[model samples]
Target chain A: MSDLDLLKYTCGRTDLSLICDLIDPGSSVLDLGCGDGLFLRYLKERKNVRSLGLEISAEKIASCIANGVPVIQGDLDSRMEFAADGDFDYVILSRTLQEVRHPENLLDEIVRVGKQAIVSFINFGYFEYRFELFFCGRMPRGRHLPYEWFNTPNIHLGTLTDFHTLCRERHIRIVSAEPLGRIHGILPKWCWPNLFAHSCVFVLEKEK
Target chain B: MLLIEPQNYDFGPGEENALELDCRKKLYEVTLRYETCGKLNADRSNAVLIEHALSGDAHVTGYHTPEDRKPGWWAEMVGPGKAIDTDRYFVICSNILGGCSGSTGPRSIDPATGKPYNMNFPVITIADMVRAQKRLIDHLGISKLLAVVGGSMGGMQVLQWMIDYPDSVAAAVPIATTAQNSAQNIAFNWVGREAIISDPKFDGGNYDPENPPGKGLSTARMLAHITYLSDETMGRKFGRNLQENDHYAFDFRRDFAVESYLQHQGRRFVERFDANSYCYITRAIDYFDLADRTNGDLAAAFHSAKGKFLVVSFSSDWLFPTKQARALVKALLANHLETNFCEIQSGYGHDAFLLEIDTLGAMVGAFLANTLNEVSSGKQRGAQS
Candidate 1:
């Protein structure tokens, strides 16, 4: 069974399943910032997809090797020199977009290497973040944003509407957008996603 | 703390054991010094080949005796209950073809001439070293190796092994090495070689048998030692601190602690290493470029290599940095081979593999165990079917 199928049986989170659903079986995958290769292992076992992973930590790379996952140690901020153009069917950057040096450049490289890219990140413009900034007068620290102000990797945090603008700006076609959490899932189509969504996932491909 | 002694295996019959080097010059009657800690299994499937880097010999681990000062070059990693684990796998480490220790090199007496080969020694390459080891393996009656593990120049041999005899290797761990020697690495080695050559006592690598080129060889080692350590590590170690004094001596004597350290290291190195072998080995390493060998197509070089690969590099190693390792990984991935690459963050530079034993041990140990299991499982399936 694939990770999606396993998660389905185990009552796992909806967002993870949604991301797996976006990918077709037996497709080539490149997972950026693949810590411990958890998702790649799942994809390999369930979807039977050809997968490669890039991570930065040595310990995590060892773990990936131990699990028989082909992983390369590299920083996400650097250009995708190892990955060839259109080499992968799907490039995943789940919860890593906010931590990247330049999200737009990274997304461009991702879409260049992969036919499509699945980017999932915690929405900075969400109600709780706004509440923390407004009421608490500090950077948000909750379930989604668990890190402290100094150590948090979320440098370029954006919301769903900002992503829509980015997609339009870059002439990228949005295949699908899935919102997660109690507030984000129930938001009306006409309403602003900035105020509702706690976390969001967007699958994008070039207009061509 | 437990030291083990190494046993030598000498075998040669002139032309019968001839090795043709890259330069097409055949070296006959070669003496390969080797040591095996663990026993060979019934099927000989659990044999691990450990290749040593430059300046390293067959004494990979274990002391000559209980009271011996140094156990081995890689004493920390390849011992009983250690990363290599003599308890599980039969480990074999041999001195390269052109090395000083007990191997036949420039210092060895040529059977035909009845004198040390010296300048007459055949110019050997990394591939030549692997070819020599292949003979040793055949003599041991081991058809296949569980894994070929090494760092730096040793890693070059691992790459040569995979490409030369792909079917013979099940897995490879090439740490702190590139697919080929970079221009910078070549340039650094060139400077070290120049140090030895420019010495007045070098005498065209045909120095007097009684007293070799000490000054030149020591100077060459001192220059090469700088490349092994990072600036940060050097600073942490010595940082301009005066040697045996609170202030500068303002004379020709070794002023800084770093200078004294280098002098000590250089002086100690010349005693064990042969200057002529240094020239041959460095030249051999400089000539190592797998890409050039395959007409600039690196991925195609591994066309027949079906083994799993683990390529490692140190972050601070400017000589064999992460960039080089990543390029190798990229080529392997391009060939659609199973590969794992990791750039370990360390203050130690190119010498991290030798220095950082804890992390290196665990990583190598885990990788070896996983490979051993896969090989056994495949054999089991083959037998049952």
Candidate 2:
């Protein structure tokens, strides 16, 4: 099945729709770590956007080409020298922030290459994870953070507040921050998002 | 199965029509050998040019006759319903300018002397080859080719086509190639040239046509053929197996199957290939540094190009490694060109461009379809504007 069709079946499972909604129609997009190019393909089909992807896997790059999404095979952690300043309207780093070696350096690169950046990650300070770690004295295991501490790809995991602080420290303005709790869907306005939200999406731009 | 005939196109008896080579000499009475498959559509935007590699020829796909033992070099990717799909696009493959396959090369009779040009043939570059091809395309009334595709040396030509005539090409696929011939590659070419020049019978490239430098040319071909295959494939195919005996022949005879296999390749190459042509062609390849004209800025070299690109490499192709392809892709990306790159998983080395048919076919086929769609839609938008 096409990635659009697949997205329809699993629309409620993740923040792909949230990220897609944030991007304006007909905007140019650069998706980092765009696995199988599904999200870029989604942008191309639904929003009629000019989309490209940077992926390290040859297999995934081939899949992107086969699906008619322009992509360059490259490591996300390496210097993205190929991308010119403000070449893309949106540079989406969905669920790939924590996996990168240096999230701060990558965020700087994304904002430099794109006018706006959309970052999504699993919030580490969710109340259930806090309770588990507090009571059991073990590396927290939740739906998103499934792997053991020794094997998990998420090396630099952080909470929603941590992301806000990083943006503040880096002189980046947060355009919007959406916190979605798995149990209650959109987190209640009364609830503290850092403690209650399961995952979060942040739209950021570099301060002038 | 289609039976195709190779066609000859000639240009230049006049000084104005003569092609000026990179070596600062004019070449006259040039001939380009070419073959075409499928019909050119009314709009003529469906034409695809296929450039041949160092050892390849004009015949790209289809049989010359019913009794022919084999098809063209890229038959697996250019037939009906194949990756290039001759059924859908009008495909053209031409023998390069400095090639032996009926093209005007060192082997062709010199117009002035009425003998083989031999060493007298002005050294040509990849750009010169593309310039000759431009004449043929003009003669065929194709204003712009839908795509230009090639592998190895052929890929160099494809890059030249994109850069030289940016508006004339809609898309390009350069596979298993590098923009600049690496130093190691130049060393390999130098050794091959030395092999041909040092032969006793070569006699400064004036050897009798009937008694050419067979041994030296064969040895050069053997060395090159080794570069085209991976150690994994070599081990899988030969694996130290004896050619005819269970025990090793301690003397310098062909004992290993790999030795005999290389011997067969060399012998077969010497029969159809010209030693002088090899020298000129390999020299052309060695001189192919795309960034030389742009002050070593690779991206600036493609500043005017406006074509979609698909750059492919094989994982095991050390001769033109994936890193070189990556560098080329990085330059294209820096230009903000519509570029797609993939290093295919294969154990066949540089020859994987020809051998890895299924995966390569699927990718090319889809990319071609996408390009056609985008280009046509763009034309429609232009029309409305």
Candidate 3:
């Protein structure tokens, strides 16, 4: 298979296309927790944007370098003081916000270093998860949140309400919140998105 | 199979041209021995300066003589279609200021006294070595270089070049190096220096040329050679096998193959390296700390640097570990400079920079190509507007 085909097979998450669709051409981007830099490569090839990535895995970083994508081995939980204020047009955290130690601080850094942030995350308050917890009385488990509570990396999992509240408290402007309901059903236009949406993608900006 | 002839660029003769040492001393009549490969394009933007490590020299690649047993040190990474492909870029490698290989060091004559400088040779720093190279770069009539690349101590030079002449370098690749010398690094260097100084034949840095302090120098080299390798590589390469015997000699007369191998490495090193030169160069490395002038703020020290950067380290390079490379990458990023960092998996330890050419070479080749493309495209954009 070709590189693009391989990328699609490996990294074709539902939110990847959403994130790519939002980024404009000729803009600079920083991808946090960029796995194998598949999204960044896709952006570079199609959108013609200058991009870089921060990946924690050495193995993934090797793949990124082999494909000529620039990446640094760094943790998203730590302070991103390395990046100057507004250094990038966009900073992307794809389904990795809940996995970080300090999601609040990371969000702050994201909006500070990047003019805008493109964030995608699984909604813990989806109808299926709420129903599971209400009936089974166990930690939510399904296609998205697959791991058991003990083995899961999604320690700070939150619902759409929690994210929106945090954004308000942080004085961040949520330009748009894209609700995706892949497993449950077709999401009705803006009808109880927090309960209906299985996942969400938010385009955020620091309040001027 | 191109034969490369070494060339010498002499400068620092007049008062205005005197090179200042970090020790607050100025030296005149300096010479830099260098070699060039490939061609310099019309715009002179294809130049890539390759810096050598502790014991490396100007002979980066190609044959000095066809009958010679081996090609230059980095022959694996620098020929046509290689990593820093000579076919695509003009490559320059020079013996560092304090290096023994044809570069002016303790072995060079002190014009005032008409004798070798020896102990009198001013202690240099990584910055000083880079400054000397800058003079050569100026003499070559090249205003900007496509990249400055190196590993180990050479990596330090590449870092210094980026900061010292930020406008001159389009990109830099500092491999297997640290922003500052660590305490353990200083400790290792101290032991080596003590070995050389305590040797009876050392004669206060005035040893005879015919029969130098071989024992001490050899011992130092042996210890350093150990640092360049890891426990895994040592076990895989030599283990505890007896040398030339199935059973142990049961004596101190070199039974293990590892001992014999170290002894061979030391002996060969002494034949080609000058003891005093080793002392000065290692001391220079010891004094190296990029953040010294900025009150220990590494990020502040790199505020003025401008260029894309590729920082590389090895998984097993404990001497200059991945942590150090991360620190540098952080500093570069703090300045909002374009930086790419990777810690390659290898069992070759600190010496992996020389051995893991396939991965290192690919990264370097891509980085250089990307940098060139950006530069040209930027220029074209500028022209159109």
Candidate 4:
């Protein structure tokens, strides 16, 4: 692939851009499953945020190193090597929640490490996906969920409401719940986002 | 800017001799050196210490004449107005103990033997590295540090400082590192060591000065370098791309660009780094079990530390994953120490901290500024009270 194509393949996603915009510039950040270190590099340059990436791939870690980004190759399910107690201002899980086997435990870990955790997931409850399930009787495929079911990394598919309910059940305080869609080239409203939006971004905190 | 070349200058009388440190039965000699820039003032609390990674030198940031080929590895972050802000902070980077970069290492002539210690050099741990740093700090007469920051093996030294001499550091930033090496990590190190020793030219860790263990060391570095990156990054950058044309050459020559790149990295590294030092340093990293040393409690290691900490990790970095950073947060919480953790979303793998300058720099700058403010205000309140 060309350099531009590689860059686009690694980055060039609207959801990442939106998430980057929402994050406070100077806040400490931890990006889980940060692919190719693009978003972290973006946040570092534009926002001046101290960031770390936790990826599971060796090649990505090398690229991060080549680019001079700080990264660690590790699984999210295991105990981290970082020294204990609320070490980060924010821990971000972008486009990685669904792929994890036990997201609830991961969320608990995120809340434990950061004061606030921003989790962005593709909303499977969106009308287009629902229509695909009802009409075609198969899993939906779109810009967000591009891969076929067999080859897809997304294992834990859930809707906006389902995530909201899970957060409430787990006593996770919803700092902000917003929906995202390509509207005349802008993000749409948070409420009834499933109707018009393709994805949901949830900024949550552990309820004391 | 006035360029200073301390390496070219001869050390004043007795400076060349190594100072012995006898800790009971353990005897070790620390080789001390310093490079001062601008003025040497006691009131200027802007002193910053840059701890180099394994096989790194004292040169933190600078370009040695264009033809010299090798530029400072961190030249991007440590310039006048750069993220490290050399104008504001008096940066002091040193080659660590057990390192080949002008510091005490296996190659140094042992005072007792009169010959190079070779593999017979005392096995030093991360704590030993920090202990040597403490001596350097004491000799410099810098009572408190503005910040102690490092990545990978350097990050391990940063952690050791916080644990060993808590009061000396004001802020600690350990990026893209683990508190201790795991079994898998140890295995990787072992493989690299074996690769070096298995080489015919290694000569039992004392390869001839003319022809050192270049082949094996390069191969070891190539293998280790591969582990430092992510699959996605490699796929995106190299992606089975051929070196010269579309078709792969059937011969043993590097068929893919990635293979060529690895070969280049390995060859370049062998030119600058020593083979034996790699074996010793990797062993030190494997023996670095901070929790075990602190009685199976990582929190206890930082219990007495009063300074604020910034632990950073990168997403997609499997070598030192976000979970390790989270465990650090948990330990710090248990200790009730003021801390901030950030997992930057980066696909840069283990090297994200060095690459993602915008995020890491900003976060470090802001965190340091805030912590310094807190420290000043607390001192002010105490004075008023």
The chain A TM-scores for the candidates, taken one by one, are 0.89, 0.94, 0.93, 0.89
lDDT (Cα, 0-100) at A113 in candidate 2 = 92
The number of the candidate with the highest DockQ is 2
Q: Report the lDDT of model 3 for residue B256.
A: 90
Candidate 3: misplaced stretches above 4 Å? Answer: A1-17, A20-28, A36-38, A41-51, A57-69, A75-90, A97-117, A123-176, A182-189, A192-198, A203-208, B245-248, B379-385
Q: Give per-residue CA lDDT, model 2, range A36-148, as digits (tens).
A: 88778777777988888988887777688877789887777877777778989999998889898999999899899999999887899999899989999988998888899
Q: Is the docking of candidate 2 incorrect, acceptable, medium or high quality?
A: medium
Reference-based TM-score, model 4? 0.65
Q: Report the lDDT of model 1 for residue B250.
A: 83
TM-score of 2: 0.91
Q: What is the lDDT of residue B131 in candidate 1?
A: 91
lDDT of 4 by residue, B201-226 (tens): 99997777568898899999998888
How much of the true A–B contact set does each candidate keep? Answer: 0.62, 0.81, 0.60, 0.14
For each candidate, what is the lDDT? Answer: 0.84, 0.89, 0.89, 0.74
Candidates arranged by TM-score, highest first: 2, 1, 3, 4
User: Which wins on DockQ, candidate 1 or candidate 2?
Assistant: 2
Model 1, B115-216: lDDT tens digits are: 889889988899999998998899889888988999999999999999998877888999999888988988988888888888888888889856878888
Cα lDDT tens digits for candidate 4, A1-208: 2446435743646667667777888988888887667778777776878777787765565455434345555678865556234777888898788998888888888888888888887888888999999999999998788989999989999988788888888899999866777553235564477666677778889999
Question: Looking at model 4 chain B, which ten-residue stretch has the lowest summed lDDT?
Answer: B8-17
Q: Considering the two chains of model 4, state its CAPRI-style docking category.
A: incorrect
lDDT of 3 at B84: 92
